[model samples]
Target: MYRLVVLAAAVALATAEVILTLHDCGSHDSIINSVRVEQCDSEPCIVHKGQDYTVHVNFTATRTVQEAHNVLHGGLGFISAPFPLQPENACQGSVTCPIVAGQTYEYVQTMTCPTFAPSITVTAKWEVKDENKQDIFCFNTRLQIKS
Candidate 1:
């Protein structure tokens, strides 16, 4: 009875954090369990200008990672530009390097709301890659920047 209660609670928590309708990079990417942005809980996550926000990505390691790197970009309509991936070293936060295969991990990254950015909607692409430049996972999500 205790185990069942714990399991149900886990299921509920997972569902609470899940960002459905994940946008995938391609066939090479791993399936992301969920993505969460700081403060916002629903679609078109709103971020305030000049404030910092963190994004959490939950996924299982598809392969052993000796080292991991971050790739990030922002898109608006047909135009896309690279966004600086803070720390760039994917292993620095939440989960560290030399990640073992078949294990679950949460990857965390933080970005500052661009003060000069127009109050507009954009999709951000976030990717984690292995040492050889192969993707562990890549996904895009909508965000709204506000003043």
Candidate 2:
């Protein structure tokens, strides 16, 4: 019974991805279709300390690109704090380099929560940039950190 319960929990966690109410930021180009966060079933996703969370973003590209970069931040409002992203190169992570114009793409990345983070409500924004360092698209969502 214990093994069954543990296996059930693992299966649920593996398939749980909440459709987030994503907010748009001023963007250069690209249309965001949807955003999903792991282990969240509603708005203001709960992120546990020292845990890994994945975000999947679906968008349509409006222009051709040779390279793409990932930028992430955690903050309250205007007080933005940059979060260090592993494999900052989006092309290496999810996107393929030399992206075609008018093509749709999905960006998937894993985020590791800082163990030192306070249990507080904060907003996280992620941006995929082009070769010229322009925003392909920018989006934000609310999160609650727990210890």
Candidate 3:
């Protein structure tokens, strides 16, 4: 009986570790998009004030959950505005495809900026949370917005 209990306890611990492994989703990948900044476009993209521009944040993630989701939340500090460039809208509007667990998903986030002029500084903080609102992982990226 003692041997059986020990064996069962070991199996349970192993199973728990597998279930709680670090699973991440988004632009930063050590083997893939590990560069300081995932650059999009030729840089110095031009746009007018009060207009929206799409900045693509490239990333990669190891899929651990059956369905993985990515979101982009950050601040855009321009010569004028120091807060977020857009309103507080969940980045769910940017991604659509489903990410498989244990797999690597290379993706790009197309974020909308409410208004930017001349040149602005863009900084993004991202978090991947499970369906239960548990944070699976986090990542940060920064870029210089030019127009």
Candidate 4:
């Protein structure tokens, strides 16, 4: 009976650990190997209003991109203005440009939660484009916030 109880506890802990980790929201292109919200290590990653968080992305570029940018949209019409990816520096933007084909890259960015933000769920979309305004890679994730 003691062993049974220990096993049950272990199982519960494991399940809880999994629940605390961020979950991928949708399928992405092969180029985008993985997208992780560092701040949201657990499911429904929670963010405090007026705090800062980070997102980590792993991907491979299939073709060279001269100009790149990213756009993030959240619930209740919250939209992050388009920004450059700085592909030459390893695609370090919501949009990364000038990425060389056949190379793997890891990108990380820290963002601030606005003070005016309300409690809600948010979906962040990231993309990389070329100078011609064509998509190279795209990925997204979901998160929660509290005031």
Candidate 5:
């Protein structure tokens, strides 16, 4: 009976680890009010080897957001090398030069999961900056990928 109880407890703990969550880390700016990963509602989003995902963000910027930088990092913390991402225009080919203050941004991007994408957790971080390169909004989310 004791062995059975120990095994049950171990199984429960292992199950709990699978349900990772994307949460807010420290932020220098408060422009980003909320972020929701449409794919994953209550659990860590899972990405297939080759698939696309949509991320919706609601923010209230005090000033215009001109350009943004994105960095993809592995789950092993900052010591690991960051994946390279091409710079993207914040406007997304819209006529708007600068994003309006009180607006929400919806971005749909292909995961482009590498051929050797490890079956591990990863975080994608985005930061929008003004002309002075000062951060206006920054956010990150954790997700799991299956290679």
Candidate 6:
């Protein structure tokens, strides 16, 4: 269905675009409150004292509901790398239909960071919404990668 596609696309975009800076959305602090590092291959990944290396970071986002709904199906995604989300598709700030209540959406993304510092943190953020831009839920997470 077209609605499903839009919802999927929104989530995909948030996942793909990794260049987003780690600044909270203006006046939307509550939208991205909790960010935890669920799992990681390694913590404080150590790199050579002065050498640089590449490490991959993975994270998740669990947003809260903004409005009462029977369900909240499709949600958007976010990334901290320079990668682009759904580069082939052309949708920005788009919306899909509302989902029933008590439903949670999950998304995953991978990014490359320099093992330059002792460690680096990556965070993801996104929202669940409907076709009219009504926000249902939002989420964010942080991953600590050591060098």
Top candidate on TM-score is: 2
C-alpha positional error of residue 103 in candidate 3 after TM-score superposition, expressed in Å: 1.5
Rank ordering of all candidates by lDDT, starting from the highest: 2, 1, 4, 5, 3, 6
How many steric overlaps does candidate 4 have?
11
Instruction: List RMSD in Å for every model shown.
Output: 6.4, 3.0, 18.3, 6.4, 8.6, 15.9
Candidate 5, which ten residues in sequence have the lowest lDDT sum?
15-24
lDDT score of residue 115 within candidate 1 = 83
Q: Note the Cα lDDT for every prediction shown.
A: 0.78, 0.86, 0.41, 0.58, 0.54, 0.32
Q: Which candidate do you rate higher for lDDT, 1 or 3?
A: 1
TM value for model 4 = 0.63
lDDT of 4 by residue, 1-147 (tens): 999999999877554422223233432322666666655547667778877766666767677666555544454355553433334333455434456787877756666777776687776555544555555555555567798
The model with the greater TM-score, 3 or 5, is 5
Give the Cα-based TM-score of candidate 1 against the true structure.
Answer: 0.79
Q: Return the clash pairs for model 1, or none.
A: none
lDDT of 2 by residue, 1-147 (tens): 999999999998778778888698855768888999866776889899999988888888887888889899889868888887888998898889887879988889998988987899999888888878888889988989999
lDDT of 1 by residue, 39-145 (tens): 66568787789988778888887678788888887799889878776788888866787877788888888888778877889998888888878888888888888
Q: TM-scores for all candidates? A: 0.79, 0.87, 0.40, 0.63, 0.62, 0.26
Q: Best candidate per lDDT, number? A: 2
Residue 141, candidate 1: Cα error in Å is 0.6
Candidate 4: segments with Cα more than 4 A from true spot: 1-30, 76-97
Shift in Å, residue 13, candidate 1: 16
Q: Total backbone clashes of model 3?
A: 2
Clash pairs of candidate 2? none
Q: Which of the predicted structures, 1 or 2, would earn the higher TM-score when compared with the native?
A: 2
